[model samples]
Target: MDIRRYAPLRAAGASWKDIAAQAGCDWRTAKKYLSPDAPAVPPRATSRAGTVSRLVDPFTDVIDAWLADDPGLLATVIHERLVADYGFTGHYQRIKVYCAEARRRIELESDAQGRPPGLHRRFEVVAGAQAQVDWGDEGCLLVGAGAGKKVYSFHMTLSYSRDPFICFTTSQDLATFFDCHRRAFAHFGGVPATIVYDRTKTVVRRHVAPGRAVPLHPQAAAFAEHYGFAIDVLAAHRPTGKGRVERQVQIGRDHVLSGRRFSSLAELDAAFAAWVPIRRGQVHRTHGEVIAVRAVRDHAALGPLPQFGYAVTETHLRRVGRDALISFAGSSYSVAARAADGRVTKAGQRVEVRVGVEHLEIWRLPVDSPDRTPMLLARHPLAAVRGQMIVDPQHWAELPDGHTRSTTLDITDHAPVAAQQVPGDPTPSSVSGSMVFGESQAALEVMVARRPLAYYDRLAGLAAPPEPATTAETTTSESLVGAA
Candidate 1:
């Protein structure tokens, strides 16, 4: 406290209490200052230094080693290790109590020397300057999809507006991650200057030494390069570094996903899309600005999307199935029979399958050199329906000669099946084929059509099995169908 005001009061005969109140000091201190006998001594501030507690203190070194080995290790685990290895027969409770206190202190002391403990200061970036991306697991939400199948939601939050672009996928593989990036850019209508991310596996390949640049995954690098954005990987264990997106993940889980039941990943994505406008209309919890209002700045600040959008692809070398088909992303896509004959003779015929977000492309080994790019075999729209066998019409070109492009045949005879069913015919059938090994066979015939069960059901007004047609009913039905 400054003693000048109280000094004048002391000289003016005011009481020390009143003087100290005016000076904002203790009465005793005012008396001392009034005593000119006390040398002008500055107040002594308390020191944080203290004697270390020994309850867990004796085992601090052991705990330190354990923590150094694994900072995430629990106190209980450390205590057990201490007793088993160090032969310190201390009570488990004592060790546990010490551990609860020690781990935090030890970790902070170890990795963060000279780093002061304090609340994280929230930061704001200029609009279009930054976006934060993260992934969260929304566990086991689909029925008949698979057991223990988890859906992960990828979120990219515009740092300025809190505008979020979200995607849900079954995997965080390279292709899906890159695809999400592309979709996020499209959703924002522009690309941010930079994207901040936690050191997720999809982006970061491994943890390098501290203070050194982290090596990004190749696909992640390609994606960023394609989009003209910089990647800013957050420091290890520092979610607060990109707290905007981190908080959004929690908010999204609670607001959008909590207590909701979805039958598929697509349903989950649709739900997020429907929920986003509500979030945009609401005030951002952290910045206290309406998300939609802030988004205008964000949109203005972003760089225009590149001329050609990113084509994110994940390539896999898969053995062609015996049926000249390659299975990918829950669907089977066919290869040409001639291509399969040339390339897929054995059970393990390897073909490169490059899977995109909404397209599937097939590639075969380079004709001459392994170093050369694989030959592009076929491209097809990704199937939205599960278990669909997607076939490019051209992929079945190597059928026996004289067969039309659309002809489908079941070869049950040793000789060729010459009969081709009329495309729209129904039930003129009395045909069958049989194959005998090393024996001559008769000319074969095949019949294919939509079953007449539904027509007959309507005609009879009951779910009756298809019976042999009666002459009168068949004629009347055909005439009525043709006239209608």
Candidate 2:
């Protein structure tokens, strides 16, 4: 303690013993405190924490210039630019250190007026290698004669070129989901190897434990099989896993939908179409390359498109009605009859009906085992008009002769016929017989009533039914008729 007051005397050339005698401390202890080389002469913990530095000094000035131009420059960007522009060979840690110091200085000078700068790695992928897809709600589309309609906006961006394709749909059902993919692939001229998606209902069936495989919607699996692409589903609650498409959704809201009035869903789609070329034509802020130029490289790497796309089918779970009938889209299609006696159908049995643009397929899962392939009960051409009942003939053929002989109904036919009877035993004229007592009329009525089935048999033998024509034969006959 005495060294504190007498330490100043040592600077004036006082000897250690002379200073110790004045301060009442031992000469050895005083000499220790007074020694110029003594470690105890300095106060505890006063040294700076970040005093060490690697002399990669030139990049600091470049970083400073970048910061001066843009006060929000990120350390990572500065490091990237340093390497690319000035051929800086210093370790990135050095630039990071400089950036931290620079940021602190900038923050202190601004007194909390500016937002702190941070950087994220901009991911890049080969053009056709991968794409990120997501569906977003774009509020209401003011269209038609009424109020605004809710729209489900679909966004997809090629991971490599940042080239984007968008479609605004009315619903996010699996068919619409597949349709969006088809349109995106067509727009890109080829399908990517992988399509990344968040855990959407259309893509993922349910969540399970971590590292377990996610079950995909059956239609999604079929669509992927048809298009030859792998489905990449991110873990639940991880939006950043598919960050590319998520960012595009934000960009779309800002640039395409923000402050804009669209009359219809189609108009919204057209807006996206028009914006795409402009988006791809500009130089990307992160890549520092023209999007159009990058897209050229992207297309070159994409897989060639298939010759034919899948005929998308909308799937619905339906219950089989009695008489093996299932109704869909305001029409009824027949599955096979359950019994010849018209007792019942496989009623209450769950059937999966896939209604396509052209056809309807009824699939029934086996009662014994749920995992087995579903039995395809029937497929009928989808009716173009409502209230039409479509029946496959082979289904009816399994019934008894009496039931099988019933007439086939074609809703598409417009012909009309009066009720057929060989003769009537009584007529309205006979109800109250004003003109009834005529012998000649009685004879005529008797003769008509006596007409027999033999008469129709003779006529049927004379006139044979013509075979039904097929699609190819019809086309050939039409072409022949045209030639003639």
Clashing pairs in 2: none
Model 2 lowest lDDT segment of ten? 424-433
lDDT of 1 by residue, 396-434 (tens): 665454545553334452343333333233433334545
Question: Which residue ranges in model 1 land beyond 4 Å of their true spot?
Answer: 1-60, 81-87, 100-105, 117-121, 143-149, 318-351, 367-373, 378-484
TM-score of 2: 0.50
Q: 176-263 in candidate 2: lDDT tens per residue?
A: 7887888998899888899998888888888787568999888889889888899999865567777878899899988899887777
Model 1 scores a TM of 0.62
Q: Quote the lDDT for 251 in model 1.
A: 89
Q: lDDT of model 2 at residue 475?
A: 68
Off by over 4 Å in 2: 1-123, 144-148, 236-238, 312-314, 320-350, 355-484
